[model samples]
Target: MKKLLFFYFLLIGFYTYGQVGIGTAMPDPSAQLDVTVAAGDKGVLLPRVALINTTDQTTITNGNVESLLVYNTATQNNVTPGYYYWYNGSWRRLTALGDHPETITTLVNNTDGSYTYTSEDGTMTTFTVGGMMVDNGDGTYTFTNPDGTNVTIQGVSQALTILSYDNNTGMISYIDENSTLTQLDMSLAIDSWETLTDLKLNPDNIHLDYTDEDGVTNQIDLTTLVQNLETLTTIVANADGTFTYTDENGNATQIDISNLETLTSLALNADGKTLEYTDESGTVTTVDLSSVITNFETITTLVDNGDGTYTYTNESGNTTVIDVNNTETLTELVLSTDNSTLTYTDENGNDTIINLKTVVQANQKTTTLADGVNTTVSSTVSGDNTAWQVNVATAKGANNTQNSTLGVVKEADSNPTVNIANDGSLSVNLENTNDIKEVSGNYTVLPNDTILLGNASTADVSIVMPNPVGKKGKTITIKKQDTNEDYYINVYGNINGLSQLYTALPYSGWQLTSDGTQWKITNKF
Candidate 1:
């Protein structure tokens, strides 16, 4: 009995060439392993595990496993409780109907009746309605989707069928498919025709067709029109200041231009002897003035005959005499006693006096000094000579030393002490006082102000500091005199790397010094 049982098991294992079947004798030919349920409700159970994240594979203890299927039981790191399969080094959730809800982040309506849908995963999809809804005139309306699919709406009122269109009258003829034809005035829907200012035609032979007001159609040949324009009469300007126009029939008309006879320009000819002029018509006219005088002579000498008459001889040895008794000759000149007038005596012994002040006043006169720093101008008179003397003198305090001490000298110390070192450095010991300024309102500090006393008894006071640029090592002291109100010291630039300082205590003072770029608080009292 044992040998019979063993023989039956061996035969079943070898049946159908390695295909396995459970609960059934014959399995599907395509499936390597088939499990068939004979009776009660049952299904194949898959392995379930908790997945930490989509890219994690250690939860299943199979790090390099591919195509591994499992059921995720955790909801973390974008992973939900669902069936997932290992693919490309990550677990991808299997998509099924009603498995996961797809979230839409945005939905936008486009201008052309289209809708844009954006998913949570930054995926964009556009859906366009192909065209407007069209009436089919058969009690039905049709709409086209983006994919060229049509959707029909039934039970609508029937529309008319268009038969023909008249472009000239802008009328549409239609029929109801069961009634007489009717006309629709579509003039309001038609766009108005615009008049063209410039028209270009290709091949230069295109014709224009139009309908006249009398409803008569006409055609114009553009080629012929252009040829006729070329044959029209043309006017030509002649060289002799005349214009000639010829008609198509070969008849010519001439017109003489009178204004063209006027001279335009005058110049010497290239021959350097003859003068020539050009008229408006470009005609050159020459005038011969070279022969007008054969030989020219100039006066050579003049002699006074001592009888109030003179004789002159020309280069040709021709002499001429002239009476000089009528001509006045200046002999003696003298100035008036007031030095404001001058008198002149001619050869006839007659004296004529003229005011010199009037002549001097009519002309512009300017006096300039040599050097304003070391020169002095003064008027001096000696005997009958009067002149302006400009004296040059040494500048005050100019010495040979390169470095000099410049400061106010005190009464007690008539001469300030000056110390000079071998390295060309000089120092002065002088007495000076700080320039104190008192203010009760907002004030801008000046470059010369040294100490400021601000009084803020009734109201707040702000003292604006001067700019520290180019004033290196300059120091200023500001003190608040009264403590009744707020007092602010505002720096034109940064003070100790800050904009301003505030003080309200009585007699509170701040000493600020510039380090070239900005001001720094040196002392606070």
Candidate 2:
């Protein structure tokens, strides 16, 4: 029965400690252990803060324990290799060691009491081995390697390999010297860029290169050309933001005014005329010009009035006044004049009449006139000692005899005195024969002749008269002083002087022609 009891206890112990035993949330105090804990006052090996070596199941003092905290002991059996072991009585962190953290069933503790983890995909091998324990003070401890590499605990294993860094300087150094830098990366910088689109310009301000609607070519620089838009056809903006167009010349015009506010002025030299302008509001507003001047000849008029005034008479005898000083004011000025009576005001204001034709009459004197009596007379006519015999006779009675009828008698004087009656009848008295008996017998007296009857010695004579002469216009007149004396008078229409006449019978029996063509002797009757 004891053996049976012993087997029962064995079964009970198996139930308590074997793999089939009930697992405890806490390790048992009396369980067979791989490491022992020292009693109280084991200075640095206080069970709660010490690590025991599970491999030899030995109590490790200060020299054997790596730290005050429990460390994972992986080499010993029955010691849950990672994280913690049954020691004085608490759990501790450890390092994990496995091919992959995902497949890891165990982990190891580091000398610094930190935990390490691994990855499943060879992505991470060991998080930290013998990592430094950092008190983050936030219930988390960071692990680091002796070279100060960062540690990661993941998936119950270490799946990361960390590069070490200097905590003080942040410097990184390679554990291996076999690697080299190959290439680098870079970028680019820019200043500015812009794009201009279609723009139209003023025709008067800017010159365009284009085929205008009228098919003209206008080309100009931004500085010196006026666009005659009258000829532009179409305008286009080029890729360079310049303008181009077609003009009447069928040529292309280009304009490159980038950002100008106004185009520059240009001078034109064409013909004798010029085209100029000033710009305003993008248009040419003030346009002015000077012409190519010319000259011409002028005409002038002369006025008889030297005071620069003119008098004009029309066919109707009307007069007009005009000023000659002003050329622009001169219209048609008709002038006229008449005869020697033409008169005008002289410069001295004198009324001066110019006489070119005037008539003058000469003075004349007559000698004898017997009232109610007729007589024959003769006298000596003299001018400057040139003497001639003059016989004066008158019209006779019906008997062809002197009215006195002294009969036929003789006359002695070559010149006789004569009295003329109003009836122009005359009688003669002989110089010596005065008796009626001596004057008896029928007697006859002739004109222009002195007749002596009975004898040539008698002083009585009969004067003869010729036919009456016609009166002629004379340049000068001569008058006889004594009316009682009968004088032979000579008359001439025109005379150079008294020396130019013939001496024939003086003027007693002479007849003068009207035009002075000839002189002839006529018989006294």
Provide backbone clash counts, one per model: 0, 62
Candidates in order, TM-scores: namely: 0.21, 0.10
Give a tens-digit lDDT track for model 2, residues 161-227. Answer: 4334332332323332334221111000000111122234547665545545455655656654223
Top TM-score: which candidate number? 1
Candidate 1 lDDT, tens digit per residue, 90-190? 88899887776844355455656564554455655565433336878898888543344577856666555545555445344657657767564432321
Looking at model 1, which ten-residue stretch has the lowest summed lDDT?
A: 189-198
Specify the highest-lDDT model's number: 1
Off by over 4 Å in 1: 1-381, 384-388, 391-433, 485-492
RMSD of 2: 71.7
> Against the hidden true structure, what lDDT does model 1 obtain?
0.61
lDDT, residue 369, model 1: 47
- Each model's lDDT: 0.61, 0.33
Candidate RMSDs in order? 32.5, 71.7
| Residue 315 error, candidate 1, Å | 72
